[model samples]
Target: MPVLETPPLVHETVVSDRREPFSDIVIIGLYAPKIAREARPGQFVMAVTPSGERVATALGIYEAAGDRISLMLVVVGPRTRELALLERGDRLVLAGPLGNGFQLQALGKNVALIAGGVGLASLLLPAQRLLADGARVHLYYGARTAGALVDAELFEAAGAGVSLATDDGSRGHHGYVTELLAREGRTHETIAACGPSPMLRAVGTLARTLGVRAQVSLEETFACGVGACWGCVVPLERSSAQAPAFPPVAPGETRDYVHARICKEGPVFWSDELRW
Candidate 1:
């Protein structure tokens, strides 16, 4: 079956707004039925404010119910700043949940999840989905201080092995999540991560060095979450000689470079394939 194009979504309101361990933004979305159900774990949506500022908000499918979907975002840019200020009962236009999501099959292997700051949002639901399928999960992350960590309770409640690191030494370990992964991540069957670019890069490097299978979800400035807009393209690769082909685009390209669409093809991809 072909992937159905999600309908244009309409935002109902900002249901929750509270400061957590990461940044200082909390927003929820009320979308159409078409978008809410078809949305996958790694896809994101492009939202436009009434004032006409177009920005891509990359969020994970942390929760969903009926025609309503929830997304957690940090107010960081002019568009995000404007978005976070909306009150209840506000109407906003959105297009999503686009992009290719985390592949579930590869998740069968021994799994480790790494996240930093709000990047954890992208991995939370995927973690839940993984655990529901009886996978042993190890999670690692970092925050500026104890107050900067977000959503640890959710993962802990799910029975996942969780660890933390804080920059100011107010948490589990006094360092970065990568450091935590370095110390405790050995023996994992595979690895998956989402975080700041540097952290993802580190996860990719470490996974390659250890010869573990790894996948990463990248965040980038996107124009059209669909492939038509080249604005969001990043470079990536594939093992052409023996890899399965993704229809439409050629199976793989030179490892040096390939245009990756954060809106359509990704948010999640093999870390080694990316042309960082």
Candidate 2:
């Protein structure tokens, strides 16, 4: 496949901002018009601090609408704390609507979306898009506790059925959310998920068992938001349009695959295409 030109990165001033605390996580909403207009479901942006105090961190472009975008983040480090501290009227230097986002249009009419903890950020936009298209969406969300399963009503408002689970048994199901998906999710034609690797793995496994297509968004700590660093890579079974070219390794087969840069090639991959 031919390489396409990358979109120019832009800096959008934060027209508005706020922090919503849910358990230990924080969801920051930044009003960035360009990003809101360009961003697609499941894509991310590198949010740089105003002072340039540290390297920018990758964050999901959670919600986007006319001139506003939101990011949901877990305040786990100093970098995240910096973003969490921003109040209304502060500025946020954003890099892009980077990486491949979910291909919602191709997911058919019945879809199940699974989210784990902060991973919910990556799927909200997808759910909204799917709902807007008149698709039947079921959101299977899980967190460490009931309080951690934040903003589920947002999905409900978008016309998606919401199901919940938590590790501490403080919510709907008394176990991992994957279990909820496995038991109640067989009806969907596609499964879309974003979360910790283990949860993603389980969702992938379940999708395969049910003979349903799945797209999983991986969670990685990226050293660079761009593909040059090769720090965030995941094994894939086939080359994608976004992957680099490789020489064939055998007569009838192309190279088995290569480690694709998650930051550039994808944070989301077809479950069957991934070697992991």
Give TM-scores for every candidate, taking all chains together and pairing residue i with residue i: 0.83, 0.92
Poorest lDDT segment (10 consecutive residues) of candidate 1 = 12-21
Shift of residue 172 alpha carbon in model 1, Å = 1.5
Model number with the top TM-score: 2
* Tens digits of lDDT, candidate 1, 118-162: 777777767777888888887887877887777788898887889
Model 2 TM-score, all chains together? 0.92
The lDDT leader among the candidates is 2
Global lDDT for candidate 1?
A: 0.70
Give the alpha carbon lDDT tens digit for every residue of 86-146 in model 2: 8788888888989989988778899999999999999999999988999999999999998
